[model samples]
Target: MINISRRIQVNAQSEANGVSLNRSQVWEGLVSKARNAVPYVSAITECNIVEDQGDRFIREVVLHGERLQELVILSTEQQVEFVRLSGNARGIIKNVIEEENGELYLRFSFDFSLPGVPAGSEKELEFATGMQNSYLDAVRSTLQTIRNKVSQ
Candidate 1:
């Protein structure tokens, strides 16, 4: 199996007034429409929640470039201010609204793995890492877009 991970911290403050932002509002806005997140997520060009049950749902997203489809189970926890999504054979993504040093921020972590690849195979690991690394720029751009779009 190949594993990939990244942590992105987004500043959540009003640029004009320097006021603290609302976590719930940001979360609601992000999940309200899957397309709203497309700009912030480089790999996913399309998002559709196929199933919904209040705090839990099934989302179908189309990956960019390759045009692959991935299905994920998503859950929200308002108390902890976090949203978690896991995909079969793909990986897991976690987004958390956090306050550090009295400043609000959004922390995003994504872990990816290929199910069938042998974990000990160096060649496979290298190939997988190279494949995922190609999308790094898109990912960074997506995060920047999210931070800019929301922090305004």
Candidate 2:
């Protein structure tokens, strides 16, 4: 079995505060946002309180598109971390976060690997790449929803 993980980091500078969002808070917002997003995330998805034990999380989403069945699992267990996806996705950093002369920035990371992938196999790369692209899009949509809900 191949180990996969990915994450999106955002140096969110809220108009009211510039502190990093508490990890648990961020995860909560993510799960809430995803739950309401539908199809891309929808109500049927599974997100857990502890994904890997020790300040980590697990978000599993089942989506249909790209002419294939897709399953995405993202594990954020490290500080300088990334959300990892597996099965058909390589994992990706979808957004970039940074402070440019006192401005907010976000950096997203994505990565993944397929089980039983033969060495030097292009098919494996395809699976990982395709999933990364699709999942990144999902994350972006989900984040936007979160932001909107929070501001309201």
Candidate 3:
């Protein structure tokens, strides 16, 4: 089992340009990404909301040429959690909106494992590192996408 986690401050760059996202706007963007991640995640080539139940839904996405199903739970403007139901990756990924000193921040975290990979082995470490980098880019892209939408 391998575990990777990280968080990036969403408004860090926006603060310099005088363009910032509030909690609600960020939350809306999160939900939109959850419904159809192809726009936010570069690796996700296809996305479809298979099931919808208000704040909770099931989505199917093709990520890196692999098909995956995820149960998405939305906690209003606070957080969005994606639990992988089927795929090589098995775990929970969360997009959370937080506030510190009245400044908004977005946090992305994930816990997952490859079925046959030995924990703590070099292979696992290498994979984790790549995944971490990919996820960091995804976070930055998500924020940028939201910023673009807000500006439009």
- Tens digits of per-residue lDDT, candidate 1, 83-148, equal 224333365555555666765555444555656666667866675666456445543454455445
The digit string of per-residue lDDT tens for model 2 on 56-143 reads 3444543453212222233442222435443344443333333456543334555445556884488866656665566566655555
Candidate 3 — which residues are off by over 4 angstroms?
14-17
lDDT of 1 at 8: 37
As for TM-score, the candidate ahead, 2 or 3, is 3
Estimated TM-score for each candidate: 0.57, 0.47, 0.93
TM-score of 1: 0.57
**Model 3 over residues 1-152: C-alpha lDDT tens digits?**
65666666778864325568888888889999998899999999999999999899999999999999999999999999999999986888888888888777788888888778877889878878888888888988888898889988
Flag the better candidate by lDDT, 2 or 3. Answer: 3
Models ranked on TM-score: 3, 1, 2
Task: Give stretches of model 2 more than 4 Å off.
Answer: 1-44, 48-54, 57-97
Residue 115's lDDT in candidate 3: 75
